[model samples]
Target chain A: MWQLYQFPLCPFSRKVRLLLGEKGIGYEPVRESPWLRRDEFLDLNPTGQVPVMVDTDRGVALIDSTVICEFFEETVDKAAMLNGTAVDRAEIRRLVVWFDSNFFRDITAPLLEERMIKRLVHRTAPDARALRDAMKAAVGHLDYIDYLLDHRTWLAGPTMSLADLAAAAQISIADYLGGIDWKSHEQAKRWYVGMKSRPSFRPLLSERMDGIPPPSDYDKLDD
Target chain B: MWQLYQFPLCPFSRKVRLLLGEKGIGYEPVRESPWLRRDEFLDLNPTGQVPVMVDTDRGVALIDSTVICEFFEETVDKAAMLNGTAVDRAEIRRLVVWFDSNFFRDITAPLLEERMIKRLVHRTAPDARALRDAMKAAVGHLDYIDYLLDHRTWLAGPTMSLADLAAAAQISIADYLGGIDWKSHEQAKRWYVGMKSRPSFRPLLSERMDGIPPPSDYDKLDD
Candidate 1:
C-alpha cells in the first residue's frame, strides 16, 4: 500500500486524497506536519511539502500533489479526472493551477497563516485585518468560480475534472479557517455542496486540526 | 502556430520557451507584461499572467506555463522533455515544480522585483538588503543544484527533461539580474553553461528587457 504523508488541513494533500479516493487507489495516511519540517520527511521529499505518496516496499516516493495526481492518472484508468483531448486537458490543468496557486495564495495561505499557523504555532491571536483581507479575497474567488460555472457544467467543462477537486480542496481549507462567506455566492456554494457530498470529500471534512474548529456549516452539504 | 504571450524577464515564460524550443515547436512571441494586467490580456487570461499559448484559429488558449508545457508535450512528440516511465516523470515534475515555485520564490522573483520592477515601474532603487538576501539564497539554490548534479546526468535523471529546462530558465533570469554567483558550484555552473549554450537558450539571452540590462557576462557561454 502507498503511504500518503499528509496533514488534515493541507489543501494540497486534500487534493491528492480526493483523487486517490475517486480512483479507488488505496493508501495508508501517514500524518505529516510539514510546518514542523521533520528531518525524516525532508529526506523523503527535499522540498518538505506534504501530499507525498510513499510505497516503502517498492521504494518509490512521489512528491508534489500534482505529481501524485498525474502519476495515478497515468497508471490507473478508472474515473479519469484529467479527461478528454489535449485542449480540454489544458483547460482542466489551467484551472488546477488557478486554484492551487492563485486561490491558495490569496485566500487559503493567508487564512492558514492568520487563523491556523499563528494560533497553533506562535500561540498568538489571529490578525483581524489579515482575516478580513482573506475573506474579501474569497468573495472575488467565488465570483470567478460563479463566472466559470455560468458556462460549463462543472468547474472546467462538461465533465468533472481534477480542476473541481483542486478548487474544492483550497476552498474547503479556506472555509475551515472561516475565510469563506457564502452570501451572494450561491452558484459557487451549490457547486461546492455537490463536491462536499462526494465520498472522497467526506473523510476530509470530518478530519479536524487540533485547536482549530471549523465554522458550524463547514461540513454540511446544505448550508 | 501558437502565439506565446511573454516578457523577456519572466522565468515562467522562459521555461515554456525552452520547452517549445527543445520540442522543435515554433511560436510567435507576443510581448505581454503581466504586471501591467491589461484588460485585453486579462480577457485572454483572467489571471493576467504571461507564458500563455494561444491558437487563435482554434480559439484555444493554454494558460499557465506548466499547463502550456503539458499541452505541447502531449501534442508534440519530437523532443519529449518529459521523457521516461511514470515514476521518472513524477521525479521530473517534482523538480519542475521545485524550480518553478521554490527557486523562483527564493531567488528569481525577488531579484526581478528588486532589480527589474523597482527600476522600471516603481522608479525606486532596489533594496540592498533584499538584493543581498536573494543573492544569498541563490548560493544555497546553486548548492542544491550541485548536489542534484552529483547523482544524475540531468536534474531529474539520466535523460534531460523539462526539469532541466525549468531550472535553466529560472537560473538564467536570476543570472541576468546578477543574483547568481557561480563560485564553488562547479557542477551546477557546468550544467548551466551547457544549458545556456543550447540553441533554445540563445534567443532568450539575446532578447533584452527594456531599461534593465543584464550583467556583462550574461550571454557568454564560456564565461
Candidate 2:
C-alpha cells in the first residue's frame, strides 16, 4: 500500500493523486495542510511539502511530484504512461516543468494566494497590487496555454501524460476559485473539458472546499 | 554528434555540459545569449531557453536541463554515469530537482541577478536588502546541502551521480560571481574542491567571459 500525504487543493499533490488513480494504484490519502506543519508530516518529508509518497511495500518515501510520477511510471505494470520515444519523454518532461514553474507562479499562485489562501488563513489577505499583478500574469499564462493547445491535441503530445495532469490540477483549482475565463480561450477550454472528464480526474472535480464553490461546469465533466 | 545550445555561465546549461563530459559524449557547443534569440533557436525551443540539446543521430531536440540529463542517462552507457537502481535513480532525480529549485532560486539567482546581470546588462544593482535576503536563503540552502553531504559521501548515494554535477555547476557559477562564502561551509567547500579537479570540469573552469574576471581561486580546482 502507498501512503500519500496531500493537500486537496495543492496542484502538485493533485497531480500525483491523478497519476495513482490512472494507474489503478490504491493508496491511503493523509490529509495535510502544508502551512500548518504536523510532526508526523515533517517526519514523512523533512522538506515539509506534499504530496510525499510513502511506498509501504518498499518502505521508501519519495518527495517531489515529478519524481513520484516518474517512479509510478517505472514501477506500475500498466502500459507506460510516458508516451513515444526518448524525445517524446523529453517533451513531456519539459511541459511538466513549464506547468510547474510558469503556470504555477503566473496563474495558480496568484489565484490561490489572492482568492483562496487569503480567505482561508485568518492573517493572510490579498494584496490589492499583488492581486492585480496576479490577474495580469494569469492572463498571460492562459494566452500561452491557448497557443500551445491550438496546435496539439494534448499539452505535450497526442497521448495524455503527467504533463496534462499537472496543468489540469492547476486549472481545476483555478476553476474552483472562479479564476478562469474559459469563454475567451476556445482551444484551452476544449482541452480542459476533455481533461476534466477523465475517470482519473473525477476525484478532483468532486473535491469541494469548506466555503469555496467551483464554477457551474465543475461537476459537468463533459462540459 | 550532439549539439548543445548553451551559454558558459548558465548553471542549467553547465549541468548538461558536465553530464555529457562525464559520460564521455562528444557534442558541439553552440553559444547563445538568452537575450538575443535567433530564429533558428526559437524554432528549436519556443521558450527560447538555453541548454537545448539537438540529438543529431536521433533527429530530436531535448530541452530543460533535467530532462536532457535523463535523456543521456537512458540513451548512453549506464555505467559511465548516473549509477544505481530504479529507486536510486529516483533519488538522484529528486536531488537534481532540489538543486534546480531550492539552490538556484535562493543562491545562484540572487548572486547572478545582483552581481553579474546588473553589471553585464547595465541594470541597477540588486538592493542591499534583497542581497541580504538572498544570502539568508543561501545559508539555509547550504545548511541543507551540508547535512546531506555529512550523512552520505555523495549526494543521493555513495556513488557520485548527476546530483553532484548539478550542484557543482550551480556552485561553480556562484563561486565565479563571488556569491559563495566557502569558509562558512567546510564540508561543502571540500567536496566542491574535489569536484572542480575532475578532468570533466576543466572546460568549465577554463571558460572565460569576454570582460569578466573570476575570483582569485576560480581556477584552483583544489581550493
Candidate 3:
C-alpha cells in the first residue's frame, strides 16, 4: 500500500493523484496542511511540502510530482506510461518542468493566491498589479500551450504521458479558481475538454473546497 | 553531433554541459544571449528558453537542462551515470528540482539579481529587503543540503549523479558572485570541493566573465 500525503488543492498533489488514477494504483490519501507541517510528514520530506508518497511495500518515500510520476512509470511493469524514445522522454520532462515552473508562477499562483487563498484566510485583497501580471503571463503560456497542442494530440506527443497529467493538474486548479476564460482559446478549450472527460479526471472535477464552488461547467465531463 | 545552445553563467545550461562531459560525449557549444531572441532558436523552442540541445544524428531538438540530462543518460549506453534504481532516480530528480527551485531562488537569485545583474545593467542598488529574504531562505536550504551531504557522499546518494551536477551548477554561480560562505556549511563545502575538482568541472572553473572575478579560491578546487 502507498500512503500519499497531500493537500486538497495543491496542483502538485493533484498531479500525483491523477497519475495514480491513470496507472490504476490503489493508495490511501492523507490530507496534510503544508503550513502546519506534521512531524511524520516532515520526516518524509524535510522541505515540509505536500504530495509526498510513502511506498510501504518498498519502504521508500518520494517527493516532487515529476519524480513520483517517473518512479511509477519505471516501477510498474504492466504498462509503459511515458511516451517516446530518449528524445521523447526529454521533451515530456521539459514540458513537466515548464508546467511546474512557468505555469505555476504565472497562471496557478495568481489565480490561487487571489481567488482562493484570499478567501480562505480573509487576508488583504489580491493585489491588482499581481493579478494583471499573472493574467498577462498566462496569456503567453496559453498561447504556447495552443501551439504545442496543435502539433500533437497531447502536450508531449500522441500518447498521453505524465506531461498531460501534470498540465491538467495545474489547469484543473485554475479552472476551479475560475481563472480560465475557456472561450478565448478554442483549441486549448477542446484539449481541456478531452482531459476532463478522462476517467482519471473524474475525481478531480468532483473535488470541492470548503467555501468555493467550481465553475458551472466544471463537473461536465465534456465541457 | 550534439550542438548545445547555452549561456556561460546560466546554471541550467551548466548542468547539461557537465552531464555531456561526464558522459564523454563531444558537442559543439553555441553561446546564446537570452536577451536576443534569435529567429532559428525561437523556431526550435517557441518558449525561447536557453540550453537547447540539437542532436543532428537523431534530428531532434531538446530544451531545458533536466530534460537534456535525462535524454543523454538514456541515449548514451556506457557506465550508468544517473545512479541507482527507480527510487534512487526519483530521489535524484527531486533534489534536482529542489536546487532549481528553492536553492536557485533563495541563494543564486539574490547574488545574481542584486550583485551581478546590477553590475551588468547599472540598475538601482540592490533591494535590502529582498536580499534579506533571499538570505534567510538560503540558510534553510543550505542546512538541508548540509544534512543531505552529511548522510551521503553526494547530493542524491553514493554515486555522483545528475543531482550533484545540478547543485554544483547553482553553487558554482553563487560562489562566483561571492555569495556563498564556505565556512558556514562544512559538509556542503567539502562535497562541493570534490565536485569542483572533477575533470568535467574544469571548463566551468576556467570560465571568466568580462568584469567579474570569482572568489579568491574559486579555482582552487581543494577549497
What does DockQ give for each predicted structure?
Answer: 0.93, 0.66, 0.73
Winner on DockQ (2 vs 3): 3
TM-score of each: 0.98, 0.92, 0.92
Candidate 1 Cα misplacement greater than 4 A, ranges = none
Model 2: which residue pairs collide? Answer: none
Candidate that would win on DockQ = 1
Residue pairs in candidate 3 whose N, alpha carbon or C atoms collide under 3 angstroms: none
- By TM-score, rank the candidates, best first: 1, 3, 2
On a 0 to 1 DockQ scale, where is model 1? 0.93
User: How much is the lDDT of residue B83 in candidate 3?
Assistant: 78
TM-score (chain A only) for the predictions, listed in order: 0.98, 0.91, 0.92
Candidate 3 or 1, higher lDDT: 1
Q: Which prediction has the highest TM-score against the true structure?
A: 1
Q: Name the lDDT value of residue A171 in candidate 1.
A: 94
Q: B58-156, model 3: which lDDT tens digit per residue? A: 798888887787887888876456778888888889889889877887788777778667767765687778777766676676788898877887788
lDDT (0-100) at residue B220 of candidate 1? 96
The iRMS of model 3 comes to 1.5
